[model samples]
Target chain A: MAALVETINLTRYFDIGRGQRVHAVDDVSLTIGEKEIVGLVGESGSGKSTFGKTVVGLHGKTSGSVKFRGETLPQSYRPADFQRLASKMQMIFQDPYSSLNPRMTVGEIIAEGLRLHSTLDSKQVQARVEEWLVRVGLQAGHMSRYSHEFSGGQRQRIGIARALILEPEFVVCDEPISALDVSVQAQVINLLGELKETLGLTLLFIAHDLSMVRYVSDRMAVMYLGSLVEIGKADAVYFDPKHPYTEVLVGSNPEPDPELERRRPSTAIVGEIPSPVNVPQGCRFANRCPKVLEQCRSVTPQLITLKDSERQVACHLYN
Target chain B: MTGVMTSPQTIPALLEVRDLAVEFATYGGTVQAVRGVSFSVEKGKTLAIVGESGCGKSVTVQSLMGLIPMPPGRITAGSARLNGVEVLGCNVINGKDIRGSQIGMIFQDPMTSLNPTMRIGDQIAEPLQEHRGYSHKRAFSEAINLLSLSKIPEAAKRARQYPFEFSGGMLQRAMIAMAIACKPSILIADEPTTALDVTIQAQILDLLQDLQTETGMAIVLITHDLGVVARVADEVAVMYAGKIVEQGSVDDIFYRSAHPYTLGLKLAMPTNDPDKQHKLNPIDGSPPDLFAPPPGCGYCPRCPFSMKICDSRPPENFEVAVQHFSRCWLHHPQARISPAAPSIPRELYVGERA
Candidate 1:
């Protein structure tokens, strides 16, 4: 199957001070198949969000190519091109309350995207808005209400509605349900699952929570300090994570099982994440990795595919 | 049942809260933010208060700490005993003395918790000066030690830097330093890890656990994430509609939860295994409004097994086992307390094979 979206060696760097640059996203390459949900899992400052934004043309890429439907994205993204792409790709932000324009009513918020991309008239837009609102598990009467009037869950539903009303084939769900209550989070996840099937949407679900990502995504990518450390089928990556970072991430998460809780080995990864601006010479996670080799400091590893599996890992251990 | 001894070295409870009820006098009505909530934290152990937003977890702890303001909100009735002293009834002088020295609190956002205008050293020293009346030299040295304890590298140099100079994780460490400056016997952490990413979250949780073991201070961790509660909490308190619906040892609550609300919450959490998608059973409907609380059980409207008796009368908190209790009609003797029926599908309970 042809990829809906692909990034070839995408990189993003920020100049912090004199000659010091923060390589937020460095040489990341991945592809999202049509109607497939790809989860980008990582911790703080892993550059997952930055990478997502770069793909969607929100952030200017420092180097490398982004292709949408086999066409290479322009160096300096044009608004016209961006608008055209916006019709096929949309992003749901981390915080629903802040991402939304607070002043606009829910109706205006959902319809604004449609207005920008679609040729539908006012009546048709209203109908479409109502349709999406209902699709996201909200009432039509809620259209007149402001963002503040709704709960965290309802606000996120509005966010989903706004993103999907454009009828985008791909969506970047950046921690959509993290800020919500537990029950509300389940509702949102379930809703997204249902919507994915109904709309035939491709998703790049960026989240810190490993469990939810594992559940929702078909393929998974583990990132650390702006690089893809591991990528494989969701089940493969979670059950038999090969990368050291993935092992710690999977093990570190609190399991629901009471027996496992008792036997929880002290696999706590100590030490704070090194600053992105002054990232180390070799592997970004080398400083905190428990099984760090001497070669890990001097040589950076390329993401290479393992035998008889789709899994790819960027570590010298694999080599 | 196997004789798994529940007894650990029974240290005196550092903080005890009894029948805590907090209400806000709003134009709409008296908003009962916390209703008859009670729990205790023992020294050297971590007690996690887990619940969704508007579940009264935060409000209950805030009320216990006397952090709630007077005009709108007031503690109608409760006694919060800290270090064998009544904290809620303490005078301004005593409260101030106890706040940083005997009881410390870490809020949700470290960025907001810290003073942007002040140097990190000054912020850490504020509690020491106020509580202990330490000299500048002594306070500064102690502040550096506290920072180091929180695992901030080059504590002496970083002390001179502002809060903005530090990253989110470092800022949180700074917050912890400030919190533990006076060696408080108790620390109330309200969603301290929520703003952080998972890896950073793990680091902070480890730090908290280490600090608890080292200082022998009780920690009251307030959060909505069950994963966290499962990881760190020695005991768990599940709150709903301004009341503690279930309170037990972490094992008791996680494995054999008596409350329908707790069960629902556990079910809702997405498991780490990808094959367990069917296990995620989200509860239907929203939390009830505190301004107009339900006459009976607050969760009765949404509970799948809610009965007629559940609608008219509030169920008394019945003891399920020693030290484990839940306020639900299903657990009541009068109600048809059949052993937890296997109503939920097997796939939802049994996770995918490892």
Candidate 2:
């Protein structure tokens, strides 16, 4: 099957000043198939959000090519090109509180996308806005209210309504449920999963929660310090993680059961994530990887396919 | 085994919070931040209060320490007894005298909680100087010792540095050091590990557990994360809106919970258990508004099993087992249809095991 979206050696760096740069995303090449949810998992400073933003044209790529439907996207997408892509690709921001404009009514916020992307009449736009409001679990009465009037979960639903109102085929959900309460998080996740099936939408689900990614995504990719460490089927990545980083990450998730939590063996990954500005030349996770080798000091391992399998890992131990 | 001493239950509670009710006089109206929240902490045991952002978990703990601001907020009801002495609204002894010296608190963010301009050593030593009447030199030396006890490497060197100079994990460790400097009988850690990464959070939890063991100090853990609560709490109180809908031991709350909301919250998290491949059963609606909270059960609006009477009549805590209790209409026995289970899928059945 032809990939819906593909990136070749994608890299993004921010100039933090004094001629030094922060490597936010580095040499990442990935493919997203049609109607598939690809979960991008990583911790803070892992650059998962930056990678998602770069792909969706929220940030300019420092290097590498991004192809959508086999058409190459510019390194820094032009406003016209980006505006054209806005109808097809959109983003659900992380912080629901700050993402929506407080001044605008919920109806206006959801309709803004429609007004920009389509030539719908004002009455038609109002109807579409109300329809989306109901679709995302909010009532028509909530349309005239301000963003601050609703709770975190309600605000997130508004965000989803705004993004999907344009009928974007591909949406980058950047930590959509992280800020929500546990109960509300499931509602949002289920909504996203249902919308994926109903709308045939493709998603790049970016999150630090490993277990949640396993549940929502068809395939999962693990990134560490601005580089891909592992990628494969969600079950394969979660259950049989090949990379040492992925291994600890999957194990570090605290089990909800009290008895199991007490009995589970320690899976502590020591050492804080290093500053992106001062990234090491070798493996970025080498400092914390339990199975570090002498060769890991100077040599960086590229993602390599395992024998007779689709799993890919970027650890020298596998070699 | 000291036959003179009985079981842990008989041991007088180190800190007892009875029917705490706090109201915030907001411009919109009166916001009932805490409504009849009652729990107790025994010596060396941890009682975790788990709830979402505005669920009164923080307010309950803050009220215990007399930390709630008085102008807009006031404790309208209840009493907190420390070793049988009344603490809440007690005029005999100032609450401030007992706050840091006896009932110490560790807030969520260590950076803002600790004075920014002051050095960390001084910040940790302030309570010591103020409460224990320790002089500058003695308090400074004691602060370094406390730092070392918290497992901060090169404690003496780190002590002289400001709060910003230390890393996040280090700052949390310093906060622990400050909270425990006096060896207070009760320690209230409100989301202490929420701000740290998983690895750092684990380390902080371990440090707190170790400190509890060494000092035999009761810990009042207020947090929203169920996993954290399960790992640390000896007893758990599940809060919603402004009330504890369920309260029991970790096992009772997790395996045999009676409240529908508790079950909903549990099924919502993405568990590591491989058998749970199906979609989570999310509670369909947002939490109740506290400004004009429903007169009945706070959770009646979102509860899947709510009965007709639940709309008008408030549910009280019904004892399910020896100590396990749930505040729900389903436990009323006669209305026994087991309030309709939330909209969980049939394939991903929720009550199969419970």
Candidate 3:
């Protein structure tokens, strides 16, 4: 199957004054199949969102190539290039407050993308706007109201409506449900699931919660210190995670069951995540990994697929 | 942190809260933040108050801590008795004395809670000087030790720096160091790890557990994360729309949940554990508005199995098991036992492979 989106050695960095530079996303290459939900899971400073933004043309790539539908996207988006790309690829921001134009009514917010991408008439646009509002589980009356009038979950639905109005082939959802309440989080997740199935929309679901990612995504990718640690089927990575960081991530997730939580062996990884600016020379996670070998301290392992399996892990133990 | 400080020999309960109600008077109207909330934490036990935002979990704790202001925010009714003293109604609120000596609080954001200009050591040592009457030199030395105890390396040198010098995880450790400076009997941590990364959160949770073991102080944990509640809490109180919908031991709360709201929340959260596999059944709507709280059940509007009486009269506390109480008509024996209880799939609660 042809990939909907592909990247080659995608790297992004920020020079934070002086002689220092923060390596946000370093040499990451991945492919997302058509209509597939690829979940990106990582902790803070893991650069999952940075990678997502770079792919969606929100951030200029420091160096590398991003291909959409076999066409290489420009590293630095020009006005015409970005506007053209915006119709096919869109991004839903993590924060609901800052993402949507608070001044615009919900109708206007959803219609902006449609207006830019399609030539639907005013009557048709209004009809689709109201339809989208209802589809995302909002009342038609909510269309006239501003984002500030809605709750976090409702605002997120508005965000979804806006992102989908363009009928983008791919969408990058950056922590879309993290800010929502648990009850509302489930609602948003289900909404996304339903929309993905009905519209055949491809997604890059970026989140920190491994559980959520594992549930929502068909395949999951783990990033650590701005690099891919593991990528496999969500169940494969979750059921038997390969990388030490992935293992720690799976272990570190607090089980909701109290009995199991108490009974389970403690797998809390020691030490904090190293600063992205001063990342380790060899394996980025070597400083905190429990199974660090002598070679791991001096040589960084490349992500390699295991024999007869689709799973790929970047760790010396597998090699 | 000392269990000896709140010895049960002196007082029957470590902290007793009875029918606590907190109200906030806004220009719109009086918002009932907490209504008839009650729970108690024993010595060395952790009571997790679990709820979503606007559910009054934070307000209930703030009310108990005597942190609420009088004019706009008032403790309309109820009593919080600590050490044989009625601490509510601002009667025993010797701010520095009570809070500094008897109880300590750790807010969600460690950065904002800390003073930017002040040295980290001085901030941690302030409680030592104020409550314990320690000298400057002694407090400084103790603050360094506290920092080390929080697992921060180079504590002596780090203490001389400002809050900005420390990272988020480090700053949280510093906050813990400051909160426990006096070894207070109760440590109230409100979403201490919510802002931190997953791996960093584990370290913080571990640190809290270790501190509890050493000091033997009861902890009142207020958080929205069910996973966090499961990890740290000995007892769990599920809150909804400014009320305690369910209160029980960890086992009862997780294994044999009685209330529909608790079940909804449990089912709502996605589990990474391969052992539990099922489609998530999210509750239909958001929580009720506290400004004009429904006369009957606050959860009636959202409950999947809401009975007719659930909307008109608030369900009385029905005991599901010993020490397990749920405020839902579905659990009441007198209420019609319609086969359509809002129970999550039984398979979800069962552990097959574990």
**What TM-score against the true fold does each predicted structure earn?**
0.93, 0.94, 0.96
CAPRI grade, predicted model 3: medium
lDDT of 1 by residue, A1-319 (tens): 6799999999999888899999899999999998899999988788999999999989898999898889898865788988878888899999988998989999999999889888889999999999888889899888998999988888999999998888899999999988888888899999998888888999999998888888888999999989999999988898899999999888877666656766777666877667788879988879889889999998998999999989999999999
Q: What is the lDDT of residue B35 in candidate 2?
A: 85
- Model 1 chain A: worst 10 consecutive residues (lDDT sum): A254-263
- Candidate 3: pairs in clash: B1-B183, B1-B184
lDDT tens digits, residues A121-151, model 2?
9999999999999999999989899999988
lDDT of 1 by residue, B140-178 (tens): 889999999999999999999998899888899899989
Q: Least lDDT summed over 10 consecutive residues: which range in candidate 1 chain B? A: B1-10
TM-score of chain B of 3: 0.92
Best candidate, TM-score: 3
Error of 3 at A175 (Å): 0.6
Better of 2 and 3 by DockQ: 3
Ranking by DockQ: 3, 2, 1
Candidate 2 lDDT for residue A180: 82
